[model samples]
Target: MSTSFAAESALASPADGTARTVIRSAADVSQLVNRGAAVGSDARIVIAIALGGVFLDAYDLGALAFGVKDIAREFSLTPAATGFVASAITFGAIIGAFLGGYLTDKIGRYRVFMADMFFFVVAAIACGLAPNAWVLGGARFVMGLGVGIDLPVAMAFLAEFSRLNGRGNKAARIAMWCPTWYAAISVSYLLVLALYALLPASHSSWLWRLTLGFGALPALVIIAIRSRYISESPVWAANQGDLRGAAQILKRSYGMDVEVDAAALRDTKAPVHKATWSNYGALLRGVYLRRTVLATVIAVASSFAYNAVAFGLPVIISSFLAQSMLTTILASLALNLCFAFVGGLIAVRAVPKVGAWKLTVLGYAFQLAALIGLAVVGRPAGGAQVALAIGFLAVFLLGQGFGPGSHSMTFASLSYPTSLRGVGVGFNQTLMRASSTVSLFLFPVLSAALGTKVFWIIAFAPLAGLVALLAIRWEPSGYDVDAEDFDAAKRT
Candidate 1:
């Protein structure tokens, strides 16, 4: 029996009610909308607000560095305690990413996003007011939940909002999150510096409170803006068989003008039936199996490599420089600015052409060389060694900036269709966060035990990632995400 409204999703038209457009092939999907699909101004605003969720993640994550010394001093924490402070957030992030990705899809992107922000608000304040290291660690865990939950939602949001005529180059658009993290850390450094200059050392301990609390502020701002402007994903909406509702949202929330031709949307609906665990079994079968493998390797590799640097920057930098806490903060922020942020930008421009797998492969190769050079040439307290470290760092970052760092998220999002996107990205993120958290926990001890030799150990992840890239070689470059949904429909 056919659905009375036809077998179509939110992109299904009510224009005539009976004759709704249905997509059964790629030919039905338009790479560029010729008519009736107007890109809305509100779409851009929504992207910004969704990205605010990511920016909040970045802020909280970055603020930890600024807070660490004060947290250790205030609590007189042992190395284990200190490690707990860093790794706890990562643990929460892993869980949250797993849950958030699945739940965001089960619920809706905006609902999970809003729900996660509240975590940041409450957790940020708790971190600011924690009486002891344990309490502070717990608070960081909460903030990490908020951070983890938002990442997949934010990625979904960015792609959905930018869905205009082959602008599937949304990775280029959303890689802004990388730079945003850099900016967050930079601001945190400046904030810490300002407080240090103005407040006494006794008060500087509390400044960490302020720095940690600052993570919530961006979330609040984002929530405010998103509430006013954001629309749920039209594609997601269509999948839910809320075509009329989706269209109304596009017009009202996003300020989209022009009629939505259900025909153009690759009209499809989300399963009215609830998906079960066996649904996950489907991802490992047939064509999608390769996608699953490819994305998983990328996530795992990016998580290991990125965490080796992003989470352990202070420890790594401390090995080389001896000026001040502020100097350490500033130098770490500089790497984010030059490497992570610019890397994202360069990726947005070039990734579509190079494809995710190629970029990831190239990134691993460069990262491997850079890590080897750093390990060989690195010497503690030597000027030339420091110079070499910095040089290798730049070279390493360029690889990340161009490939794994930028393309990882891109691949994560595009690797699956909408019905499965949340789960796919979520699973990928969870694994990624797991690798990152494990490394976060182990890095300090390993670095202490092995020092520059740690780089040698870290190099293996990317090498494995490179191998995986070759094994599962699908590139999610040009298809309108809408088409993937249609492909899924045909499979049924």
Candidate 2:
């Protein structure tokens, strides 16, 4: 062996030398990992790569929403055909999320993140060149799969990497993704508007193609940067009997040069046993059971409700602008600018101090009020009421931006142990994406059937969520996030 390899091997924690696994039916996570939780440059590099994936997630998803109209015109789509094309990706996401979550738990995080990027690049290309509505729909579905798979992986990376760095401010980092998502949506909107201005009406198809093609750019950049910045999860590596690989990745990818305290790195205190299925069962028997349930609920609720609005934003705006095309376009653009960009940034700052749960409750409350106002104002009240309804809709969307709107995933992912971290997060992410699928179908039907009054009724969802939050106290604000699943790791 080379001198560097030998040296790294010597420094690796012996306890982590063997893969320490927690089987779904086992209770072995009694204590392990986390002798040192200080921030490493390698962890930061991982963060950079993960963030890149998320940026693409934001960009691709946002691009489609903004490009839908141009695509409709390009393909001469019927309303139903357009809706099918638009919602295709969400359906793909539901499948990708479930499979990704399962694979992430089984295969590991870095592998999945790397694989998903390829999906983004190839799928974006397909979408841009799609010859017909069916083909475009197929491409979008593939793109959705990429987005769905990436979400949990991104969350898992953030959680584990931040834990190593001893930063409980992980929520702050994840919450920032919300605004980045908004920024992505806004960029696509602006890009399409610019394309509209630059291109003649005869070649409008080019505009949509260009916008769709642009989605691939972030993923490509991310893949290249990732070679230098991405590292395997130290916690995950350690659990998988790759201590030396973990350290090497840490040094090279994150540029971490500090000497690892060997004695501290391998805790003699952590329980060790042959891995078994019962380790996972232990998660459900006690304190973990409640946590699992709470996080799952939040995940499901957030995915359903948030996407119901976000993915539906343009369509909703399109409906509102029925007669006046120009006004419709301008108003929709303004809403995105305010809600996705400005409002989301404000939310990022608010999360750390206000706490994710508090913001969630506050966000839900704002949405409820806004929904009621929208319903009442939208009644037989005519154009004046319609104006008020539009105004209130923006307010409600901003409220969504603040709480259950974007940062819900942050809370769910950060609430578990390193051993169960992948699975807990995977399950939550699966459900979250699944909820989005349900909402994608339900939102249009709900809006069309009940009209604006549908919102007032839907507002009750948050009230239920609010009660769950209060009853469960699934808060992650002050928790020593690193030490959380340490116990679970030992038993495993």
Candidate 3:
């Protein structure tokens, strides 16, 4: 080390004589984190906790899918009113995503993360106890706030804490979101089924209440476990010019012990760009503009299609089949478990090898075929028609779970540098949630008017998505987000 840079130092030695590092700038902090990940640090605890937020997000969102009908029946709701109830959470999510993104960057990741869990707990209890449609809608909107805020922080934690080698690679870690989401959805289904089976026919009203409120259980559990393991992101610390803080976090959380020369940090200056609401404009002005567009299109297209069909699965099935409520819920539960769950698991395993680009294209192709089949078959009147509708539904879910479902969040989160990653994902999720709000509100109204022709209209969303993918052709899987930005800056 230079004598000028060695004025302040802490000593740590192993079998080797000495190993000394200097934390002079954000780059040094980045290197420390990257090296820790490369060596396969105990990051699983961090990742699992981060992903727990996603599981809760999906579970809370999908919990209402089966309960919507009962909610309508109990509250004497019109179709428009029911649509509002379904859309309320997404509407709140739009605002939450926008603000949460800016706040995650402004405040520390751990602060924002721990604060949001309280939203889940309170809102979930309110939703369960809602006596009227208005109250339920209000409670869901509040719960949506937690769901929306949790995502950007959770994703940032996952990416920053992750190692770039072996199974802990960027794509694989990001791809884990899909399976966890599906797992949450499947669990909701099973919970509903168990409640339905155990409850007496006269007490069927309590079923939906239990389902909606049950979301609090997991939220509380995650909060309890995460508190013990949470650590601030080293990159965020480095960005703030706290080299010692970053080094301590690495040693304490990641188990990477090293001596950081404080004198070196005093000698050099790293660029300081704190995230603010104004910085959001930067996404559209420079190199990030194209990436922003691609992420938006994919996220919106996926959200539109998924919300239209999946969120309203109960309503769609009820229209086609004149079965008992038990039968309807059972069939929907089976479809998600067998088809969607399996597809998501396969994508989690296959994405690193197949690449995000190819998997998404293939998934869209499957969606196109299934939708066209639905358009031709219409609603199932006979035995053959019934099988075709069910078969096509399976194909569509398979495609979604296999392709866009896994990569939409992955692309947005991995496309930007740490300075802007939270806002990048927050913005992406905002548009997606907006799309979700619109789709959920419009699906019932449109389906009621168009009948089976609605499938034809919904099919076009995935087609447009396919076109966007083929045109852009940027595959972010396993891309070095930090290095790429430095390279670009150097070129300019």
Candidate 4:
């Protein structure tokens, strides 16, 4: 678990003394990346654009949070219909993650990354223009598809483009998705607030449409600049026996001017694992099984609790305080920015030092305590009680930001090597989205039936996460997982 930025001798020119750095195999490219990017390289820009995709996923997923009630009222819907509309996007994400994961590995990260942005544009427009419940639900499901597909590719870009461990290591970059996600959620809240204030009293219902539609703006921005800044992962290219293509990408993106070693090129072997349906099964077998199980549990638990509380924050706040829409909006925005967002930033800095495991455990503990306090307090009746209730909510979110929120992706993305990275994230997200669908669809029904007692049920999620972490004791931060790809190649 050491951190360094020096390139290995494997990337040095051969004894014959050629001017260019020589790449003999995929391992050479991986070693170069593990050593860290060259100063002022375009690699950082590629990571930023990849993070833009994560921003879109968060924006679209949370955009509907405040709007769910309006959607239910406009469609004159029952509870079940409202749930369907609310949960449709997650359902779409479930399917999209499964396919997107395989496709990211089967094709290349660049192709998958470029394609999902269009899904956001088309689906956002469709949701805004929908005339009926069915159309709105359908549009959301399509948007969910984009959200689902984007994560696997985005995580892959962050991990592959980053060094193994250091200031901007793989774990830290992957954990960045956490803050970017909260930042997107905060932006959505700000949009909702702006629309709430600006719209005429008679036209206030238009607030939801405008908020949801604004999602396309960032997607379009990413699309326009993608070709200039983004390129296929050099390590992935070398893994595919394309040393020449890999060398070109290294020069363009990594600022490393290297050449394919002619003698080594002649002896290059095929990649150990080709993209195929059977790779999904590989997740459940041998060494991967334990890591896969641990990552899946972490993701499912995190998604279930987060989707229930974060997505339903407005409703929960309004219920506890019985406040006006304006008050609820301001309160939600403040709690997220002050607690959750800041917590994510802390996790990003702390992971490379304390590691993902200890922080996640601490986070789950905070959430567990917060949930129990909320259940015990029920709906606040007095000033002191109300303050306590809000404090509990803040504690829960703070825990989320630093713990599972930041590191769930850490566990999911870093547990496997480049060869299996796509499928690894895909499988984790697929199950995670399923948990989200269940939570989103059931929250209204359960809250209505059980009221504040619902916190008791929600508490189980973090509890399960704690149990899994304790059982596995696996830490992903600062680990050199990409070496697995090269090691498997050597074995074959």
Candidate 5:
């Protein structure tokens, strides 16, 4: 099978040129990565490195959840200012997602990968050393840039590198982002707990600083090893007419030895893709329009609900259980790691089996149920309140981890061609981050005003998502990249 597959992709020459080379299309690249022998060690390491960036993104974003209260206290922030501090990164993320998507497509994935890490390093340092709310918010916004930029490139690499068959394909690879995100969230909680326990009262101010600053360490590690381990996406390079460069990377990265014809390269007939502002409208037209809408709906809905609940979990739990700061931190850690992390793992496994549509629907259902439960239970006093609050919150996080939480990015990443994948994801993420920014900013205000009724209000986000998912039913799993309308448009 291996020999036949390789022979099928062996060297060839076109009518226009005499040179012979492997006649690899975007489809062939998909097959080779998905079903070929190259899907072993290199694939795993590449997935790890790319997903490692995901881990850091999650860590940096979530680290603030536990630290928000401490920051409010230390900086003497008003409620509105506290919301701004909590949501500052999200505001920056909106900008990052828009610009990063364009830059990723215009420049290249490798360059973006190398460049975005420093955003984390510098921003994390600034956040740790910030002396005022304004400075802290500014630093968080910068960190958001790193978080926002890394996602499109990382997801693109994962999809491009993965095969379409067997256990871990495109959907699976993208779904891994969820668990890695939860893992990072879990790590942040563990770090906060350890710091909270270790730090004396005199030096307790260092908890949030250390928690926020610690995110940089992983980014630095990713930077150190990324250049050595990661390779440029061959599909992307090939699409750009760099047959030799693509061939070299293929040979080196996946250990595939294939001949190349410099003369037979770059289909002159294939349309050149020069991205412009007008292209954003293309996502709203034809088949891409449907996908773009579905992805946006899911991403935005998920971001809205998750940010409102997950980022504010610490505060919500404290209020619900009427617990001290220490108790709240410990409880948040336990629930995040136990429920959210578990749900993420379930999602990773379920993605290949349940399919994106069913899994996402189930996830939304879980979230809906959890929200109702919270609203019904309201604020109770005593151990029953503790039990019910944890139970409902666990269900909410679990539903999220399994459903829209992970697949939002998965849908965005896989729904477009290499030419548009970055932008597609960027656009989806931009809207999603914008939604996140709004939700995070509003959650505190709403919670204060409406109390537990906030859960009922937030539940509507998932309901909307569920309706969109059931209506669209766009399953991106095992989708053929070459078949995207964008590619079809390019030829015509």
Candidate 6:
């Protein structure tokens, strides 16, 4: 229960001449994780699985992008109804994030994670076979819940499983979500393309359903293997005053042979921060308020711009550039893979060295400039002008890959320790999903009404993100935020 107890119990060798790490408290478990996992440890596999969850989030969110029009035609939906169907998932994500955040902290990461996979598999199948617009919308909403719930826990795994600092540090691991997200989006685009080619012209209308249904494949794969590779977060267990449970998790997940001290097991003190509704308010008070504000703004802005541009990308290309559907798909796919995905990769590799703040700033600048260029160019009449418009769109996505895209979650996850990580990311995602709902609903209407001028409105997103980053100047990379939990525990 004391600091000296933790220090003394940090390590020990058994009488049989084998080394066994001693975990006496939450701090001890944190120390082991902070020191990084052993090579080829299950900890790395856990991180990979967490990223797979992220892949699902991106895939489901984007799978419907190209098929909205088909859905509209098939369902005989009005523009307003179409908007509702498109935005329903985000609405579900909004509610899911709020609840999932609390549940993740209250129930534990493993339970929330394992349970959300069912949401994806079931919802995806329902979406594919829905009989009407209402059914499709409901199914998509369920899928959105899975996406919402997955992010907070996925981020927790990434942040907790990796070391506090280094090439693959917490910041870097968290930032990797950006590239993984883009990769998932690219994969969805590829799927659409493949289905488009394979499906006969007579059955082309089935494209959306088939694409959405495919989401179940990955979720089921993750579910089957989860029991083998996934384990409860050791720090969460220790925080609950279950040192024995924490030690076991370390042995299985981190490949560390650890034993809980008898005295530590006997000490049944309450955790530093019990999972409570009040913790949500804590994000807006005292030290966390500014961080919450900055992270929320960055997330909202990123979501708005991305949902508006990326989700509507096929439409923009087909209508604005006057291109065919095939051309639109290929262009969108190439742009995402070559620019957005590549940029995300750069951000992941560079964040550890260059810092998240600098890259985010540079990324926002690129987005802002690109948006302005698109606004100025308007609808391109000539071939060169068309190329320029596409170039601007590519630039905007490229900026997104590295800047707010990669670091928004970085700020959200690392700004809080394990105690508040779930709620922190949950709160951030809740607002971000709300923004997505608005953007997804409005982009079609706005584009129809304003034409290319909509780029000017979209330009505001990155600009806001840039302003927030400059004003706040809080960088999450390389920071030892987990120490806060121990400091608070000591105070109690």
List candidate 4 segments past 4 Å from native: 1-7, 10-19, 268-272, 489-492
Candidate number with greatest TM-score: 6
Model 1 lDDT per residue over 1-492, tens place? 122322244343466554334443222222222112345456667767877787788778877776677788889999788888867888899889888888877888878888998999989999888898888889999888888888988888876666432334565555556656556666777777787778886677778888888777877776677667877776676566665656566566545432444454554543432334454666687667777888888879877877786667776776678767777767876886777667767766676566666777888898888888878875656887787787787778778777787777777887666677777777888888888877777777788788788888888877888888887777766545445565555334
Angstrom error of the Cα, residue 450, model 2: value is 2.5
The deviation in Å at residue 147 for candidate 6 is: 1.3
What Cα-based lDDT does every candidate model obtain?
A: 0.71, 0.66, 0.81, 0.89, 0.81, 0.88
Q: In candidate 6, which residue pairs clash?
A: none
Backbone clashes counted, model 5:
3
Q: Encode model 3's per-residue lDDT on 294-318: one tens digit a residue.
A: 8888889888988888887777777
lDDT of 4 at 135: 94
Instruction: Estimate candidate 2's RMSD in Å.
Output: 6.9
lDDT of 2 by residue, 224-263 (tens): 8777667666556655544455555545644443233354
Best-performing candidate as measured by lDDT: 4
How well does model 1 score by local distance difference test? 0.71
**Which is better, 1 or 2, measured by TM-score?**
1
Quote the positional error of residue 35 for candidate 4 in Å.
Answer: 1.0
TM-score of each: 0.87, 0.81, 0.92, 0.95, 0.92, 0.96
Better of 1 and 3 by lDDT: 3
Angstrom error of the Cα, residue 488, model 6: value is 3.0
Off by over 4 Å in 3: 1-22, 35-42, 484-492
Error of 1 at 381 (Å): 6.2
Pitting candidate 2 against candidate 3, the one with the higher lDDT is 3
Residues forming the 10-long window of minimal summed lDDT in candidate 1: 27-36
lDDT of 5 by residue, 74-185 (tens): 9889988987888788888888888888877787888998899999999999999999999999999999998889898999888887777557878888999998998888
